[model samples]
Target: MPKQMNFIVSKNSFEEFGMMVILGTTGAAMETQMNFFFTFWGIFQLKKGYKPGVAGMPFPFKKLGGAMFRKMLKGFGYDDMWEMVKDGVEEGKIKLYPCSMTMDLMRVKKKQLREICEEPVGAAAFLEMCDNADAVISL
Candidate 1:
């Protein structure tokens, strides 16, 4: 596990958020260090009190999908996304890095982010982090 595991997230819709958690936690169980670099729409996932929903789904089916998604999570023996995020960070398996460039471009303040997030990182810093990564995935 010498490879630095990093996930470059670009969205935070229901599916996107779920996938990121699945991948991040998988790395968590592996005991390999992991990073989640949230950018663009993904940045909101780290914003304080933000609740991800099935926004990408059509209006009518969104409510159904969201209910099903929550049920699926419970079936998998997990609570909420934020709980997993907090656990992962506390366990030192995952670090949340919200893109500073995105934050600036979007006029987001550091205080607007979740307390679990590390200091905002710029593009160059993010690239430097990924320079040692085994794989850099975008979603």
Candidate 2:
């Protein structure tokens, strides 16, 4: 059997989400099963119409640099991070799950999430899913 991979997303930043999409898609393309678990602020990324911008930089430069970086990516013919993630889902290369606890704490409804979110699961459930995974990555 092929390897199963699990990713935990805890940050609500563009860089983190972007890396998740990249790895998720690439892993699936490589014939691995990939699952993404979104928690905490990361749940925001699963929200409908959420746009990820560059994060993790010091103030002032983060916003400006993010916009410039996105523009550069566009010029290079790369789809925006959200589009990439959606495409990954559409291609059956990614499975998305929002953390149930985070959803409850944030008062987020299922309808508020993008169609890509398969379901909401608790931390224990998430761990169970990862128990047999060949690799588990946290972002």
lDDT of each: 0.83, 0.83
Scored against the true structure, residue 131 in model 2 reaches a CA lDDT of: 82
Runs in model 2 with CA error above 4 Å?
Answer: none
Judge candidate 2 at residue 27 and give its lDDT: 87
lDDT tens string, model 2, 44-128?
Answer: 9888877666787777677676677778878988786677767768877688999999999889899999877887999899899
- The estimated TM-scores of all candidates read 0.88, 0.88
TM-score for model 2?
0.88
Q: For candidate 1, write residues 1-139 as lDDT tens digits.
A: 4446888888767777888788787788887788989999999888887767797788788757867888988998987877876787899888999998899877889999989899888889988988888888887
